[model samples]
Target: MSDNSGFFERVYEVCRKIPEGKVTSYGAIAKYLGAARSARMVGWAMNSSHNLEDVPAHRVVNRNGVLTGKHHFGGTNAMQQLLEEEGVQVKKLQILDFEKHFWDPMKELPQEI
Candidate 1:
């Protein structure tokens, strides 16, 4: 499972654009990258993104609006706390207002160069 540099960069770029209190899914990013089944690859890139200062990885969740990255967070319940601080409500690993907070780059983003 070699992590290519460009692929990771693409993941970070997309992940960085997710607004605070809003969320996106790995499958969406993979599709945006033109690899529809590469959602796991997107997750791999995110797991390796330890040095990104501005990329709020916590803002991303599973397709079902579940906070699936809780184990990866440092402090106990940190991912939920971060999301809540950004005005996203979470209840037992699920986002409260999912429809309003979900962000789909394919719809909201400008065309790529």
Candidate 2:
């Protein structure tokens, strides 16, 4: 009912579509949701998504491919560990070959119905 909850659902919907071994930026998700300036809100949604196993919160990183949300995943390296498990390279808290791994929701998803 609340606007944030609705937005969080939208965020999760996009997250579910993020394929393994790939990642997206918070800003990208916000842009795809028609809220270009709501990247921080997208980060908030990722932080709140731990309980939802299907959300793939680890696949959402900052624009520069930094693991900015790592702290929220319990361990300091939890986020990095998860991404690494999926074969995404993380070094010094940043994703290597970032662009190669980046998934743009606006491009990956079909036109909105």
Candidate 3:
């Protein structure tokens, strides 16, 4: 495995833990991983997450809760569809009531030693 595999694995693990009805920001995941400036890396990991069925890449988004990764999901609406199916509201590619649906890995998961 590549060096980034571990980081990507950590990303996927946190992503898998995201509750079905909630969503999180790439920055949030990055910060949780102790790489607050690596939000783009988190997005890159998500880009490759299609190979992992258990990784809910669609549950991740930009800081604004915008479905920025929607294009990677297949069709333009695929991401939105997935989020809607999970009871998350979307409008103009942005999640409605995002704060209510937001999930923070740092807050929900145990800290690493």
lDDT for each candidate structure: 0.84, 0.93, 0.93
Question: Quick one: RMSD of model 2?
Answer: 1.2
- Give the distance in Å from residue 43's predicted Cα in candidate 2 to where it truly belongs: 0.6
lDDT of 2 by residue, 1-113 (tens): 49999999999999999999999999999999999999999999999999998899999999999999998988778889889999999999999999999999889898541
- Of the pair 1 and 3, which is ahead by TM-score? 3
| Model 1 C-alpha lDDT per residue in residues 1-113, reported as the tens digit of each score | 34567887888898999988799988888888887898888887877776777888888788999988777787489899999999999999999989899999899787531
**In model 2, which range of ten residues has the least summed lDDT?**
104-113
TM-score per prediction, in order, is 0.91, 0.95, 0.96
Model 3 residue pairs with clashes: none
* Clashes per model (N, Cα, C within 3 A): 0, 0, 0
TM-score of the candidate numbered 1?
0.91
List residue ranges in candidate 1 displaced over 4 A. 1-3
Candidate 2's TM-score reads 0.95
